[model samples]
Target: MRLFIEVPVWLGDTIMASVAVENVMTHFKGAEVVVFGSKVATEVYKAHPSVSSVEVDESKQSKNRWQWLYQKTKTLGEFDLAVSFRRQWSTRFLLWCVNARQKARYRRLDKASIHQVKRYNDFAAHVLGVALPLGDLVLPFAPHSFARPTLGLNPGATYGSAKRWYPEEFAKVAIALSSTHDIVIFGGPSEQDIALEIETLLHEAHVTNVQNLAGKTTIAQLCAYIGGLAWFITNDSGPLHVSAAYKVNTVAIFGPTMNTETHGWHNPNERIVKLDLPCQPCMKRVCPLGHHACMRGVKAKDVLDKIALLA
Candidate 1:
């Protein structure tokens, strides 16, 4: 059988969506699973053993998205089943193009799902009449290693500064964690400036193991090294989700995003650090409140305490 799965835009969401892929394979062992994804997503799961092949959608999926996708999926050949995690009207258009005998998609957007690792599997149950027991969307695959920081700090939040815990707070966490572990820092090319700022502070504190890997390492290599960590402390970013999927003991700091439903799929051990600010979880990419109390209120000691509990 040939199967098709339309992917989510973010890395964390893709990790969780792997659960649905697992479900499809569980019921149809011999089936060939083909994934249609945003370009970056194809790279994120490049090594996935179960995927027969991945077709990258070069066109950006956005409003008026169906006009492009309708012409795109026409090339996917005939598929036996098409299952989608997307709820947009655009999803219907892609389903229309796939030459599949059966098409399954969520009837409504379900927000209560914590990890989206399992809830994403609902498409099958709704469309195929298969009531597979519910499960979390955490991937079991190990990331490829680059350099494991005997001590690691990811001080940048890819989404925006609002999601970042104070860099000084990260430095303090590093000063403390450095007492027991070697430290290396990770961030994106855009965030090298922040990584430098934090590294300089730690350097002044005479803290060693603080090396800047921001923009230096690739995502795959970073994820590989993170999987081997004794513990990972991060803001609400893709790495946090990757580490969670890797099942590393984690303490996640949050500001604009809520910690309840989006932190870690099914890992009960994961902790999200935030204060009870009334305006929290506003869901904006940037903070509307100039002060950002929800994130600023989180202290390094509070976060370290959570890591201590894990140890």
Candidate 2:
């Protein structure tokens, strides 16, 4: 069967959707599946057990992007199934153009209420009949490549700054834990400053083994590095999810906007720490009141202890 899968755009979304890829492979047993998405994500999963081929959207540069799908549809040959993680109503139109024998998707009321991971999984389970029990959505990255151990320090949250635990606290944790584990901080381009600030904190503490790779490595690189870590301490962010996805032991600190169904994480060796603040988990990236109890109240020591357990 020529199956066409759409990937979720965000990093965590992409990682979570890996489970869908594994589902497709297991459901079909020996059937072949093809994936469509940002070239980056496609490449990340290209070697994965499920994906047979990657068809990058060549027409993305053109102004009429949908036309590209239609064009690609005609050229790529017919597909047996088209499943999408994309929530835009336009996805229906895109899947339709794929000329698949059948079309499937998550049970969403409409374009407005679509959650990325649910949309992807529902389509896989309901449409493709891949209702394999929910497997961890993590990617299989090789942790053995890196010779050194790391204290996976994530300083950015995809939601926004409000979800971030204080950087100074992260530095303090690094200072305390550096003697035990190398503090190898990680994040994205937007989080260079956060990583650097933590590095500065480490410097102030006269600590070593702080390698800030934010904005330096690709998603694949980040995932690989995450595998080499002894433990991870992070806020609600893509890297945190990625770390959990790799099944690396993690302590996902929550400030706001949390629930395991969506953000709490699914890895076995993991725990979440949040203050019992009434106004906590406001779910808003930026708290209305200046006092950010959901995050600010959680102490560095608690998280460090969690990391120790994982280590």
Candidate 3:
């Protein structure tokens, strides 16, 4: 059998949606699985050994993107089944264009899921006519040669500034942890400035073992780096989910997002640091009110306490 899976576009959602993709591969071990997604999305599946092939959709232009995808992915051949974990019209249009005999999609825009991992797993279960248990967000174990017991700091949240913890606070945490653990700061190309600020702060504090990998590593490299960390401290972002998926001891700082829905899925060792402000979990890219108390109220000491407890 041949299977084509449309992955989620967002980085964290793709990581959470990997649970269903893994199920599809497991139930049909002999079937070929082709995943269609963006660069980050495709990279998630590419890192997994279970996926047969990955088709990347690099068209960033909004005007003719769907048409471009339709033309580009029309040659995916025939598939026995196809499932789209995403609900957007473009993905649905691409699903229609794919030459798959069986097609399924999750369409719950009116309703919000308690958690997205459950949403993905439930979608796969509905399609397969069996209850697929939500399991670990599994990725290939990558070995890194960094001999020191390392602590990873992810200072950027792609969602926006509302979800980000203070960079200086992250630097403070690094300075505290750097006494015993070598610190590695991680970030995307867009987040290089934030990472640099943290690096500068660490250097000013006389913590010399810190390395800023922002803009230098790809998503695959970031995953490998997270896999080898003794601990990962991050905002509620993609790397948080990646570290949690890898079962790394993770401390996730949440502010404007729903912690219940987006916290590290199925990872018991994960600790979420957040302030219980009334305006919290606003679900906005930028905080609506002038005060970002939800994030601002969470102290560096609070995160350090969580890390100490993990020890």
Candidate 4:
């Protein structure tokens, strides 16, 4: 049988949805699985053992953007099963065009509050006719090689600045940790400035072996780098969940977002640091008050202390 899967759009969401991927693969066994996703999401699934082909939606909008996209996917022919992790209308329309024999869309449980991984797993279970046990993310590779001991710092959040920790504080923490471990910074194109600022501060502090990989590596390369890290200290962002998938020791700093919903999915090595502010967990892209006390209140030492305990 042939299957088509449309994964979530965000990096973290895609990683978390791997539980469903595993379930679908298990149910179908030898079926060919084709995945549809964004560039980064495509990278996340490219190395999956069960995935046959990955189709990325790299189309930049023009006069006939939807038509172009529809035409691109039309070449896939008929699928036996199609599963979508998103509820958006565009995704629904795409699945409609795929012309699968049977289709399943993700539906949240009524009045239920759970991690996204569980939600994805539930959808897969519903489709597969069994509740599959969720497990750690299934990457194409084994646990990473640790030729050089390193610590990874992810200071930027793609959603917005509200979710990011202070860059200066990240530099301070990196400077302190650099004496014992090599530091590697991670980010996307939008976060290059924050990563570079940390690099400059580290240089001024006479710290060495700091590699600013922000905007320098692709999503696949970033996942490989994350696998090799001794510890990953990051904000509540995409890389944080990536580290969790690799089972890396990660300290996630949470501010405007709730930790329960999006924290590391059952990873024993995961640690979360957040302050209990009145307006915290605001869930805003930018702090409406402009002070950003939720993130600002967290100190570098707090993150370091959490790392110390984990070590």
lDDT (10s digit) by residue, model 1, range 94-146: 78778999887655437563545556667555565678666655444565443
**TM-score order of candidates, top first:** 4, 3, 2, 1
After superposition, the stretches of candidate 1 with alpha carbons farther than 4 Å from their true spots are 61-71, 106-115, 136-149
TM-score to true structure, per model: 0.87, 0.87, 0.95, 0.96
Q: In lDDT terms, how accurate is model 4?
A: 0.86
- Per-residue lDDT of candidate 2, residues 1-311 (tens digit): 77778776567777767766677767776666878877656766766776788877555587988887788778767787777777766667777788878776545533544444555566677665445566676575676455555678887976688889889988888888777678788877888988899898888788867788888997678878887677788887777767777677788888776544455346787888877788865778688888887888888898877766666
Q: Candidate 3 — worst ten consecutive residues by lDDT sum?
A: 105-114
TM-score of decoy 2: 0.87
Please give the lDDT score at residue 149 for candidate 2: 58
Q: Which residue pairs clash within candidate 3?
A: none
Q: Against the true structure, whose TM-score is highest?
A: 4
Overall local distance difference test of candidate 1: 0.75
Candidate 3 accuracy as lDDT: 0.86
Instruction: Give candidates' CA RMSD values in order.
Output: 3.0, 3.2, 1.7, 1.4
Which of 2 and 4 is the better model by TM-score?
A: 4
Candidate order, lDDT descending = 4, 3, 1, 2
The predicted structure with the larger lDDT, 1 or 2, is: 1
Candidate 4 local lDDT, 159-254, one digit each (tens): 988998998999888888887888898999988998999999999999988888999997778888897789999888888887887889999999
